[model samples]
Target: MASIKTFINDDFLLENKYAQELYHTYAKDQPIIDYHNHLPPNEISDDRVFGNMTKVWINGDHYKWRAMRTLGIKEKFITGDGSDKEKFMHWAKTVPYTMRNPLYHWTHLELARYFDIYDLLNENSAEKIYAETADKLGSQAYSCQNLLRKANVEVVCTTEDPTDSLEHHQAIAKKDLDFKVSTAFRPDKAIFISHDGYNDYIDALAKASGQEINTYGELCEALENRIAYFDKNGCKLCDHGLDKMYFESYTESEILAIFAKKRSGKELTGEETSKFQSAILLFLSETYHNYGWVQQFHLGALRNNNARMHRLLGPDTGWDSIGDFPQAEKLSAFLNTLDSKDKLVKTIIYNLNPADNEVMASMIGNFNDGSIKGKVQFGSGWWFLDQKDGMTKQMNALSNMGLISCFIGMLTDSRSFLSFPRHEYFRRVLCNLFGAEIQNGQLPNDMEWVGKIIQDISYHNAKEYFNF
Candidate 1:
């Protein structure tokens, strides 16, 4: 028998009796409502199938690419130039080195759940597992639609740019599939002035909205037009990817001056850039309030850190890192600025740094009144923190500081369909946390209440929060 087959029959979860009881009592059949993700809306609409397993899992996933790079695999094996087989082998070589990293767990879990293969991936088993999984990719069970069905996803929201055609989203909506699929408006390209193509993006926005981009007022009008278009097509959420919340107050005059400088084909200073960004954020927040949409801020990510690699492979190709900054003060000021004016929308704050987990979790409590218990939420463990230890820390902190009953659950933050297994990983961790509390006498063994709590965190909270 193969080592993987031996591990499969051995019942890994059964070794921990507490995990078994919790899995049976709390986590078996909960529906999944993924409120946030990076899945392409068009693929879901088309019910697309991958050309191969490597294409589906390795092509666009920077997470795996980063791990392969860390293991001294050449860039060719990652984002550079390499055949699918070569890249898969490079990943296989790195698997044994992953050891205690969450990547090891996620990779094995995906293999077992999807392929029904139980072998540990290493240099020895890599070729066999890859060939076997690749062969299975030709079957109907490995189709993209089947993957979502297997994961039991009830709803999925994909992040989309303002300039997107959304033809795929339209196709999916028209099909009326069992699961609800929608788009989240992500406008980082339009707002981030430091990007190389800021001027080009202005042209794109102008074309999309049929408005001439001459001044600041015109720019705002173009954005508003795009937002309306997005809303008409089933967008109820706006997502902002920023290093931190911008709270610097600026006057209309200041913004007009900055736009004039840019319109003249000149760059603004750092101070001017901050002011312009803050003003745009405020304008967007006001729009979110007007549309009654949920606003999500993915903060604390220091993107494009490695300039050499960034220039070599472009952005999001594993050049980003966790930022070290005091988010609470600025984030609080920004939220309060909106809250005081009664213009705050349904808000979720996700942090990258674990040290700020408690701070961000507790900060939500300061803004929550009796009006809505869970209106302001600390989102699921994000980016670098999307792992077993990170999820556990977030859950424990949120439960300790605020009402975990109202907490929304896991999101993949992934571009791959194979990432759906993440929901299962999160469920197991959640059950273990609650079960341990019960076993230790921290709480009474009321399976009903515990089950309800598990169900709410797993699915209900996200469904209600996103109003899906």
Candidate 2:
């Protein structure tokens, strides 16, 4: 027998017996409601088959690419210019270095669940696993549609650009597929003008909305038009990615002046830029409130700092890092800005820094008026924290600070179908926590109550929250 097979049989879910039982009860039949992800609508529309495991798993996942780079693997092995087989080989070489990272667990879980192969990926087993996975890829069961079905995904909401046609989304909606996938309205490109391509983006927005872009008023109108389009297509959520919340206010004249300067091809000072962005966020938030849509903010990421790598490889090529801002105070002020005006929409705050987990968790409670106990939620562990320790910390913090029963569960936040395993990971962690409490007599061993809580977090919470 293979050494990997021995490890799987001896230790898989056995490390926590209560967890094993909980998984059997809650996880196996749960329907996945992925409320946030980066899956392209076109692929889902096509119901495509991945050419191989490498393309499905590695092609666009910056997380794996970052790890590969950290291991001194050449760019060719990453997004650059390598063959699929070569990239897989490089990833195989880097697997041992993952060690205690969540990536290690995620990789092994994927191997066991999908391919039913228990080989630890290393130089020795890399070729064998690769060939075996490739062989399976030739079957219809391994197509992207089949992969999603096998994961038991009931719905997925893909993050989309403001300028997107959403033709692919419409196409998928027309299909007979079981999963009800849709798009979330993401308008960060229109909001962030500090980047080099602001002018180009403004032009694109004008074309998309069929409105002039000479003034701030016109810009707001154009945005409203796009938002309306998204709403018409069953969009009930809006997503924003920012370093932190902006609560600063600006006079109409000040914002209009900044717009004029930009329209005239003149650069605004940093203060002016901040005012413009802050004003735009306020406008957009109010729009969300009017539509009764949930607004999601993925905060505290410092993106594109590596100018050299960014220039060479383009954006989202792993040039981003975490930012250390006093997120709690600013974030509170931002929410309060809306709350005070009675214009706050349903909101979820996701933070990148783990140290701020407790603070972020508690911050959500401050805004929860008796209207909804968990209405303002601290979203699942996101980005860099999408692993075991991170998920555990998030769940513990939310449980300690607020009612975990109201919590919406895990989302992939991934660009790959293989990432549905993330839901499985979250389920295992959740069950372990509940099981431990029961075993330690922290809670009565009423399996029925505990099982309901588990199922609620796993599926029911998201279902009710997102209204999917």
Backbone clash count for every predicted candidate, in the order shown:
2, 0
Query: How high is the CA lDDT of each candidate model?
Result: 0.84, 0.86
Residue-by-residue lDDT tens digits, candidate 1, 1-468: 246565434234333455556666666677778778898776776667775667888888888888888878899888777898888888888888887788888888888888887888887887888889888786777777788888888888899988887788878878857888888999998788766779889899899889898899998999999899989999999899999887787889999999888877797888888888888898899998999999999999999989898888888899898998779888898889889989988899998999999999999998887676599999989989988889989998999999998988888988988888788888887887877778788877887777888888888888787889
The 10 consecutive residues of candidate 2 with the worst lDDT sum are 7-16
Error of 1 at 376 (Å): 0.6
> Which regions of candidate 1 are displaced past 4 Å?
5-19
Error of 1 at 248 (Å): 0.8
Looking at candidate 2, what is the lDDT of residue 280? Answer: 93
